[model samples]
Target: MEKQKELVFITVIGQDRKGVVASISGYLYRKDVNIVDINQRIMTDGYFVMSMAVDAKAATVSMTEMSRELDQVGRELGMQVQIQHENVFRMMHRI
Candidate 1:
Protein backbone atom coordinates (compact mmCIF):
# COMPACT_ATOMS: atom_id res chain seq x y z
CA MET A 1 0.00 0.00 0.00
CA GLU A 2 1.12 3.50 -0.79
CA LYS A 3 1.82 5.87 2.06
CA GLN A 4 -0.71 8.63 2.54
CA LYS A 5 0.21 12.27 2.27
CA GLU A 6 -0.70 14.48 5.20
CA LEU A 7 -0.74 18.24 4.70
CA VAL A 8 -1.43 21.16 6.98
CA PHE A 9 -1.72 24.90 6.65
CA ILE A 10 -0.22 27.33 9.14
CA THR A 11 -1.01 31.00 9.49
CA VAL A 12 0.88 33.47 11.63
CA ILE A 13 -0.13 37.04 12.31
CA GLY A 14 1.69 39.56 14.45
CA GLN A 15 3.77 42.69 14.55
CA ASP A 16 6.49 42.66 11.95
CA ARG A 17 9.69 41.29 13.44
CA LYS A 18 13.06 40.28 12.16
CA GLY A 19 12.99 36.66 13.25
CA VAL A 20 9.36 35.76 12.84
CA VAL A 21 9.88 33.59 9.81
CA ALA A 22 13.10 32.20 11.15
CA SER A 23 11.52 31.24 14.41
CA ILE A 24 8.51 29.53 12.86
CA SER A 25 10.48 27.90 10.07
CA GLY A 26 13.05 26.69 12.53
CA TYR A 27 10.42 25.14 14.70
CA LEU A 28 8.88 23.38 11.71
CA TYR A 29 12.27 22.24 10.57
CA ARG A 30 13.04 20.73 13.93
CA LYS A 31 9.80 18.83 13.77
CA ASP A 32 10.93 17.46 10.39
CA VAL A 33 8.04 19.06 8.52
CA ASN A 34 8.60 19.81 4.85
CA ILE A 35 7.52 23.25 3.76
CA VAL A 36 5.58 23.04 0.51
CA ASP A 37 4.60 26.66 0.14
CA ILE A 38 5.02 29.91 2.07
CA ASN A 39 3.73 33.43 1.55
CA GLN A 40 4.09 36.46 3.80
CA ARG A 41 3.05 40.06 3.48
CA ILE A 42 2.66 43.14 5.60
CA MET A 43 -0.80 44.58 6.03
CA THR A 44 -1.78 48.25 6.20
CA ASP A 45 -1.94 47.85 9.96
CA GLY A 46 1.74 46.87 9.86
CA TYR A 47 1.05 43.38 11.05
CA PHE A 48 2.83 40.57 9.28
CA VAL A 49 0.66 37.81 7.94
CA MET A 50 2.23 34.55 6.89
CA SER A 51 0.70 31.49 5.33
CA MET A 52 2.47 28.21 4.82
CA ALA A 53 1.62 24.68 3.81
CA VAL A 54 3.66 21.84 5.19
CA ASP A 55 3.86 18.14 4.56
CA ALA A 56 4.01 16.16 7.75
CA LYS A 57 3.76 12.68 6.38
CA ALA A 58 7.33 12.89 5.21
CA ALA A 59 8.31 13.85 8.73
CA THR A 60 6.05 11.34 10.46
CA VAL A 61 4.40 13.91 12.69
CA SER A 62 0.76 14.20 13.72
CA MET A 63 -1.36 17.29 13.05
CA THR A 64 -2.46 17.64 16.67
CA GLU A 65 1.10 17.33 17.93
CA MET A 66 2.40 19.82 15.42
CA SER A 67 -0.41 22.20 16.27
CA ARG A 68 0.53 22.05 19.94
CA GLU A 69 4.12 22.85 19.09
CA LEU A 70 2.97 25.72 16.86
CA ASP A 71 0.88 27.05 19.72
CA GLN A 72 3.98 27.16 21.86
CA VAL A 73 5.86 28.92 19.11
CA GLY A 74 3.08 31.47 18.80
CA ARG A 75 3.21 32.16 22.53
CA GLU A 76 6.96 32.51 22.48
CA LEU A 77 6.84 34.86 19.51
CA GLY A 78 3.89 36.89 20.70
CA MET A 79 1.95 36.08 17.55
CA GLN A 80 -1.33 34.40 16.74
CA VAL A 81 -0.79 31.13 14.94
CA GLN A 82 -3.33 28.78 13.47
CA ILE A 83 -2.67 25.30 12.16
CA GLN A 84 -5.29 23.37 10.27
CA HIS A 85 -5.63 20.31 8.16
CA GLU A 86 -5.28 21.13 4.46
CA ASN A 87 -8.65 19.68 3.55
CA VAL A 88 -10.51 21.80 6.04
CA PHE A 89 -8.52 24.81 4.99
CA ARG A 90 -9.36 24.34 1.35
CA MET A 91 -13.01 23.88 2.12
CA MET A 92 -13.15 26.99 4.21
CA HIS A 93 -11.18 29.06 1.76
CA ARG A 94 -13.04 27.99 -1.34
CA ILE A 95 -15.53 30.50 -2.61
Candidate 2:
Protein backbone atom coordinates (compact mmCIF):
# COMPACT_ATOMS: atom_id res chain seq x y z
CA MET A 1 0.00 0.00 0.00
CA GLU A 2 1.15 3.54 -0.68
CA LYS A 3 1.79 5.87 2.18
CA GLN A 4 -0.47 8.87 2.40
CA LYS A 5 0.70 11.91 4.29
CA GLU A 6 -0.94 15.28 4.81
CA LEU A 7 0.85 18.08 6.57
CA VAL A 8 -0.38 21.62 7.12
CA PHE A 9 0.99 24.83 8.52
CA ILE A 10 -1.50 26.95 10.39
CA THR A 11 -0.96 30.50 11.58
CA VAL A 12 -3.23 32.58 13.76
CA ILE A 13 -2.52 36.23 14.51
CA GLY A 14 -4.44 38.80 16.50
CA GLN A 15 -4.78 40.49 19.83
CA ASP A 16 -3.99 38.44 22.90
CA ARG A 17 -6.90 36.74 24.58
CA LYS A 18 -7.96 33.59 26.40
CA GLY A 19 -8.96 30.34 24.69
CA VAL A 20 -7.11 31.12 21.50
CA VAL A 21 -4.90 28.11 21.81
CA ALA A 22 -7.58 25.98 23.36
CA SER A 23 -10.05 26.62 20.59
CA ILE A 24 -7.61 25.86 17.78
CA SER A 25 -6.10 22.87 19.52
CA GLY A 26 -9.50 21.54 20.37
CA TYR A 27 -10.53 21.65 16.74
CA LEU A 28 -7.37 19.86 15.67
CA TYR A 29 -7.88 17.18 18.30
CA ARG A 30 -11.48 16.68 17.31
CA LYS A 31 -10.42 16.19 13.72
CA ASP A 32 -7.81 13.60 14.71
CA VAL A 33 -4.93 15.76 13.52
CA ASN A 34 -1.71 15.02 15.34
CA ILE A 35 0.05 18.23 16.27
CA VAL A 36 3.75 18.05 15.44
CA ASP A 37 4.83 21.45 16.66
CA ILE A 38 3.31 24.61 18.08
CA ASN A 39 4.88 28.01 18.62
CA GLN A 40 2.97 30.88 20.13
CA ARG A 41 4.04 34.25 21.45
CA ILE A 42 2.99 37.75 22.16
CA MET A 43 4.59 40.43 20.04
CA THR A 44 6.07 43.63 21.42
CA ASP A 45 2.89 45.45 20.46
CA GLY A 46 0.88 42.87 22.42
CA TYR A 47 -0.47 41.06 19.42
CA PHE A 48 -0.60 37.28 19.65
CA VAL A 49 0.91 35.02 17.00
CA MET A 50 0.62 31.26 16.74
CA SER A 51 2.11 28.78 14.34
CA MET A 52 1.30 25.11 14.33
CA ALA A 53 2.25 22.12 12.25
CA VAL A 54 -0.32 19.38 12.10
CA ASP A 55 -0.31 15.86 10.73
CA ALA A 56 -3.60 14.80 9.18
CA LYS A 57 -2.76 11.25 8.37
CA ALA A 58 -5.81 9.88 10.08
CA ALA A 59 -8.14 12.81 9.59
CA THR A 60 -11.40 12.49 7.68
CA VAL A 61 -11.13 16.15 6.66
CA SER A 62 -9.83 17.79 3.54
CA MET A 63 -7.57 20.86 3.53
CA THR A 64 -10.27 23.10 2.10
CA GLU A 65 -12.80 21.87 4.65
CA MET A 66 -10.36 22.35 7.48
CA SER A 67 -9.54 25.86 6.28
CA ARG A 68 -13.20 26.76 6.17
CA GLU A 69 -13.76 25.59 9.72
CA LEU A 70 -10.65 27.37 10.91
CA ASP A 71 -11.86 30.54 9.21
CA GLN A 72 -14.90 30.41 11.44
CA VAL A 73 -12.70 30.01 14.46
CA GLY A 74 -10.63 33.01 13.39
CA ARG A 75 -13.69 35.12 12.80
CA GLU A 76 -15.04 34.25 16.20
CA LEU A 77 -11.77 35.23 17.83
CA GLY A 78 -11.13 38.27 15.65
CA MET A 79 -7.92 36.77 14.38
CA GLN A 80 -6.37 36.31 10.99
CA VAL A 81 -5.84 32.64 10.25
CA GLN A 82 -3.90 31.08 7.41
CA ILE A 83 -3.68 27.43 6.41
CA GLN A 84 -1.28 26.07 3.82
CA HIS A 85 0.34 22.85 2.79
CA GLU A 86 3.69 22.13 4.41
CA ASN A 87 5.54 22.02 1.13
CA VAL A 88 4.32 25.46 0.14
CA PHE A 89 5.13 26.79 3.54
CA ARG A 90 8.61 25.32 3.45
CA MET A 91 9.22 26.72 0.05
CA MET A 92 8.22 30.17 1.18
CA HIS A 93 10.30 29.94 4.33
CA ARG A 94 13.40 28.41 2.83
CA ILE A 95 16.39 30.50 1.88
Clashing pairs in 2: none
lDDT of 1 by residue, 1-95 (tens): 76687777899999877888898899888888889999999999888999998888766467777788888989899999998888896788896
RMSD of each: 1.7, 1.6
Q: Which 10-residue span in candidate 2 carries the lowest summed lDDT? A: 1-10
What TM-score fits each model?
Answer: 0.85, 0.88
The candidate that achieves the highest lDDT relative to the unseen native structure: 2
Each model's total of backbone clashes: 0, 0
User: For residues 1-95, could you state the per-residue lDDT of candidate 2 as single tens digits?
Assistant: 75477778899999989999899999999998889999999989888999999988777788889999999999999999999888986788896
User: lDDT per prediction?
Assistant: 0.86, 0.90
User: What ranges in model 2 sit over 4 Å off?
Assistant: none
